[model samples]
Target: MPELYERIAERFGELILNCPPDRWEDPSPCPGWTAWDVVAHVISNHRRAIAGLDGSGYSAPGRGEDLPRAWDAASEAIKAALRDPVKARTLLGEEFGSMPFEEFVRRMACADTLIHGWDLARATGQDEGLDSEAVAVATEILLPEDRDIRMPQAFGAKVPSAADADARTRLLNFLGRQV
Candidate 1:
């Protein structure tokens, strides 16, 4: 799972670097959010995970031309935090009460990174599909029985996909993305 986190982070870094400057303002699948806003949202989630691990509040740095550098720094910080077994084991929030550190990293941090990586990729016209392993892991961890209830708030209503859709397409459709 730690490896998965690293892979997702690396892929996201690539997507960020590959994004054209002019496309930052392009609209994404996330309602009104732009491509840049999707990146910011990913950064925010990483900051929140770090804060949860350390019991410290985290805020995103101001958006600027140096956003890539800032994002890389935040991404590295998150990877580093996940590497520390002791810190990773610390219980930090109510939603994840009693869940072990590694589980939280796998289910929360990595899942968000994977999903949002797809979001950013799609927004930037870089959609080349997602890692199959990551999709499988996400399907197991993120898609709970009550997902139908919770997803509508964070994602659009589920879009239809082929009966034999691939894992990536299934994930995207399940998350309310019309891939």
Candidate 2:
């Protein structure tokens, strides 16, 4: 799972690097957030994960017009944290109370990274489709039997999809995306 997280993080970084500067202000599936905002949010989340895993304090980076650089720094921090097996087993607090660091990386960090990678690609007109393995893992972790019960609060209502919708589409719908 750590290796998987690393791969997902690398893919997300690639997507961020490929995003055109002109499209940074374009709206994304996330309500009221621009493509740049999506990247910023992912970077922020990565910081939170790093803080939780390593007991380091998080200071939000200045994303503004320097989103790519900020993302690169955050990505490097997250990858570095994940490389330490001893630190990866540390118990985190709050929402991650006592959860192993590696588990948090798999369940929260990696999942968010992959999903937002898709969101960033879609927002920038770079929707070449999500990786199949990542989509499968996201679906399994994020969409449990009681997902509908919690969907409205976290993601709003599930958007309807065609009967033949692929796993990626289904995963998007589950995340309150219209794709």
TM-score for all models, in order of appearance: 0.89, 0.88
Each model's lDDT comes to: 0.77, 0.77
* Residues 1-179, model 1: lDDT tens digits: 67887887788889999998789888988888888888888887777777777777877656764668867887787778778878767776785556666677687554677887888888888965677888998887656833543553376677888999988888778778887
Clashes of 2: 0
Residue-level lDDT tens digits of model 2 in 47-157: 888887767787665654477777788878766777777887877887675787778778765467887788888899885477788788878877774454354324657
In model 1, residue pairs whose N, Cα or C atoms come closer than 3 Å (at least 3 residues apart or on different chains), thus clashing, are: none
Judged by whole-model lDDT over C-alpha atoms, candidate 2 comes out at 0.77
lDDT of 1: 0.77
